[model samples]
Target: MKKIAIISALLPLAAGLCGAAGKKPADDAVARANGIAFKFYAAEAQKPGNVFFSPYSMYTAFAMAYEGAAGSTAKEIASVFSFPAKTKDLRAGLGAIKKDLERAAKDAEFVQANSFWAQKDFKFLPAYLKTLRSAYGADAMQADFLGKTEAARRGINAWTENKTRGKIRELFPQGSLDQLTRLVLVNAVYFKGRWKAPFKKEMTSEADFTLDGGTKTRVHMMAAPGTREAEYGETGELQAVRLPYAGGGLSMLVLLPKEGRTLADLERSFSPEKLEEIRKGLFNQKVKVFLPRFKFSSGYKLNGALAGLGMPEAFTDKADFSGMEKGKRLYIQTAFHKAFVEVSEEGTEAAAATGVAMGLKSMVMDFAVFRADRPFMFFIEDPKSGLVLFMGRMQNPAAQ
Candidate 1:
């Protein structure tokens, strides 16, 4: 997906529910979180084969930990997440957004869950727990990471699978957790929705798709009628459209670059400001929509990427999460993210799970010709709420 997608999802935080607690941040923290994620994804991680991930999931995971951060560590995380410097405002804002998301999820086949797995008998500050539960809807579970590490891993994985309807499985690779692991915080997001205007299965046909390196392959391009006055726009080199789901709250946005341009070319200049302009540029229009049917899963080990985003202290001995516990006993060792996405004639299905294992350790728019026959970016989000559940690019549907 275009790096801009991450920034867009953050907009929801800025647009709080009508009756949410306190006033929302004037500077838009969610946008800042998305920006940090893109900086890391573009420069450090994002691989080519149909990239799919939930910036929401990763950011929420870190956010839970941020509640427990202190000193410069807290300052750095606040900067990274665009959190209000005042703790109470941060809680009120996120708690309000969480309530809005819960209400929206109840109206659709959507689920976003957060859980905290702590070593048995490890004493964590109660205030930290309270904030996580109240602001993020996180549940705390005691696990024997100090003893039955494998079993703890299995339990966490089971929670993810059940929450995501099995689309995500075995979130933590074997050996990801062990005796030294003190706390594991995880967030899982799942979404299944039908298109408001479904594409005809019979209209799908073989079409040529070009990859970044000039490689071309045949792909299953699906088509739907285009006189619907959909949300769409185009620039000289790029086209974008927003394809809404059945509920109207969520939509899939596709970004297609012109023949001579590449997704990388569009990405290089994608910043929060430019992203706001593109979003504002969307207008109702009519055009044929042809999208390739593709499904893929991506997994990332995030130590390097998080460091690249300027929170290197969290992974080192210099870390301080004292607000969570005494003696500064925890530092993130590794962070893992796994996501799955599929789009076809009927609709879209996406799920993502993100976890951080501590050694005390720690860590788009739419349419025009919008024909995604070439390398392109895509993202699924709630326009009203500004929540981006999934984002990725189908650079080469046939790659893996």
Candidate 2:
């Protein structure tokens, strides 16, 4: 029995919004990663409440696809992601960031996995496969995508479920894969950590959580024990707080809109520079914190969203992925993603998985008395690298 190789790809994170002056290759890559994180957030925000997804997972999956793209296909991807000019540079930059993430994850449980699944008899350029193996450490697995499509789909889903500790399942869905599917690239990320100053269970109680339009609902609002010192800051728009995990390297950053300010206002003005400034302004202070214990999962077929973001060619016949194969040009067929998150008095656990079928194209916070009684943004990140492992907004903890 041939087994799929498990690649220790580490994970991804972000802080800076755009490419700043005097930055190294890895720093540039991280900045681009953060850029896409917000870009995707804006696209998703157009929809209604409670948006969440792992930027690192989605970025990693598409990065692999970009390796096998050529001509305008590659250019569009590079432009959308702000990828490094050279393929070798992109690989090296992402690899360096992965190592740093691994180092920072000692006190937390952070796992990243990548896989390349191909049609049993399909031929792909050795260089294309080599890039995935060497750069992303993704090992290939054979599947009869043209024959036993359902079995192939189930196998992939099972692998994803196991990798995510059962948090994500059925990523491809029935009929999502077909005979034209020649390749599938997958990236899954999982993070588990306990807050440094956890809220006492006794402090949790039912409270009214304000919703959009000033409507309210009951939620299990958790309170910090007395006045706990945390990284706190405030601006005219919002209040920010950093909740460190057991290991000092990773922490959750929460941004709560000011009393009269709407989350939409803070979101519209949110930028990398603003985030950096807020971070720089944070000071350790004893603060009263109230947050709702919430759990929710999100799923999306990112094809339309990616195309809308300026990479429409990747999904059409005009797309050129000749770098993957010479005779038959390949275009993206399907792009799928699923994510889950849980925030409680004890800690937080988040998992996300992304799959980009070659036939496809697709594709936080803060606090204050610091009370998040309404919708707020949150990020699970490596404070040092500014890598966001997971991020989302809590609209209604009562719903899930």
Total backbone collisions for each predicted model: 15, 22
Clashes counted in candidate 1 amount to 15
lDDT score of residue 312 within candidate 1: 82
Error of 2 at 370 (Å): 0.7
Question: What is the lDDT of every predicted structure here?
Answer: 0.70, 0.77
Error of 1 at 269 (Å): 0.3
| Tens-place lDDT digits, model 1, residues 1-400 | 3121111100000000321355454125455445554565576324545566787777778777777778887787676666667777766655656665666555468787888887778777888777767677777778887679899889988988888788777778797777778778888888888888889998899999987788789999999655566888778878888998886777887778877998888888876566556667888877678888887777777777767667788777788888778778777767778888778898988888888776654203243366788988777765655555566777777654
Off by over 4 Å in 1: 1-29, 44-47, 102-107, 361-368
What's the true lDDT of residue 150 in model 2? 89
Give all TM-scores, in the order shown. Answer: 0.88, 0.92
Candidate 2, 7-78: lDDT as tens digits: 111111000012356666567777777777788888877677788888878888888888877888789988
Which 10-residue window in model 1 sums to the lowest lDDT?
7-16
